[model samples]
Target: METETRDITITDIRKLLDEVTDPEIPVISIHDLGVLRDVRKEGDTFVITITPTYSGCPAMDMITLNIHGKLRAHHIPHFKVETQLAPAWTTDWMTDEGKRKLKEFGITPPMGSKGSEDLINRHPPCPFCNSENTELVSAFGSTACKALFRCRDCSEPFDYFKCH
Candidate 1:
């Protein structure tokens, strides 16, 4: 018996990649994170482009490995995962569904663009209680990309998915 290969379309590739999740945040897929920049075929080889949430993010290596593993699982033989850093990632790239998932997982998604004076005075509503009474405990949380915050109304400590 011999195995047959079929031409992979962008949708097919995306469907495969959709199963790849961010190691840190299991609730959201990498595709929802907006890290997956592009996927295309180049001379029978699949090319996957990704951007890290931030420079030196430890999760990138694992993400790349997972991409390779996923492609292999789909029986894809030749593929390349490339990292692009020119256009920095922003919280704006995150999908609304992703944000909802984050909130449901107890991580408050970015409220808006970072460093805005308006955003400075505002604290993200608590994911647990939806209270506006939240305080920034620390600028950095379990990960550099997140911040530590505590809700005054609910008395719950949570991580805020900081905007980039």
Candidate 2:
């Protein structure tokens, strides 16, 4: 016996996928993080395109699994998740809401767009005290995409989402 496929619109599927949050950062959704690229239907199959924040990002594997779980939970059977590497992902793709969420989550968001000259000299403000008197503790933070920073004012250590 064949099962009937539900006639769900692309918008609906996108909304569902938007519910999937980043495994590392639970406060932000994949869509907000700029990882989720596109959602479209190709014939009878639904295609979900995603781009990693960087090449060989380990989160991609867990993200794919989460996307699969979300779609499956919604009874979306005929779907395919594709990873696109060209036109590499950048912090510029991050949504304003996503950035705000990151700050609220105690992680400083990317200060400027990718390759911005101002970004070269500017330092990420401390999310705790909103102070510019922050020093880089390490080039790498909890994740490869972030850098560790310590705010002198607040005496707190936070992760800055590095621009790429």
Candidate 3:
């Protein structure tokens, strides 16, 4: 009698990748961030593609490591994490759940598309106070992908995830 081996499927790999979270933003999973682009199988090896939110995102290294670790933990022996930079990652790729999670984490989620001078210039509603009266204190926040903002109504300073 011959034993039948189960081939790994994209769905299975996605579930495992979903367990991985962004090192910087622990409140949301990478899956929700739309980082895990595509998964495929080549014989015994599984190839996974991902795109960083920014070209020079510092979290990409940690994110890649976490992805490998997660897959290894699940007994995925042969696999590779490929970085895809072609189309680039945009704020629009972020899942609705991710946006909600960011707001719940007290960080205002980005409202408009990336590189939209007019749109990005518009103040996003405060996550803490839900007030539109906000001011950009700094173009850069703790991370390059965020901007420091203060709500006039609540006088609370918060990070606004930049659209990129």
Q: Predictions ranked by lDDT, top down? A: 2, 1, 3
What is the model-wide C-alpha lDDT for candidate 3?
0.84
Candidate 1: segments with Cα more than 4 A from true spot:
1-6, 114-120
Q: What are the lDDT figures for the candidates, one per model?
A: 0.86, 0.87, 0.84
- Quote each prediction's TM-score: 0.93, 0.92, 0.91
Model 2, CA-based lDDT: 0.87
Error of 1 at 158 (Å): 0.4
lDDT by residue (1-164, candidate 2, tens digit) is 32235567889889998899998999999999999999988987889999999675799999999999988887886899999987889899999999999999999999767863333345689998899998888877898788888888989999999988
Candidate 2: worst-modelled 10 consecutive residues by lDDT: 115-124
How would you encode candidate 3's per-residue C-alpha lDDT over 16-110 as one tens digit per residue? 88888989889898878888788888777788899988777889999999988987777777889999987888888889999999999998888
- Distance (Å) between predicted and true CA of 15, model 2? 0.7
- In model 3, which regions exceed 4 Å deviation? 1-5, 118-121
Clashing pairs in 2: none
Per-residue alpha-carbon lDDT of model 1 for 1-164, expressed as tens digits?
Answer: 22233556778889989899999998899888889989988877778999999787999999999999988877877789999997888888899999999999999999866452334466899999899999888887998688888999989999988887
- For candidate 1, list the clashing residue pairs, or say none: none
Candidate 1 local Cα displacement, residue 135, angstroms: 0.4
lDDT of 2 at 31: 94
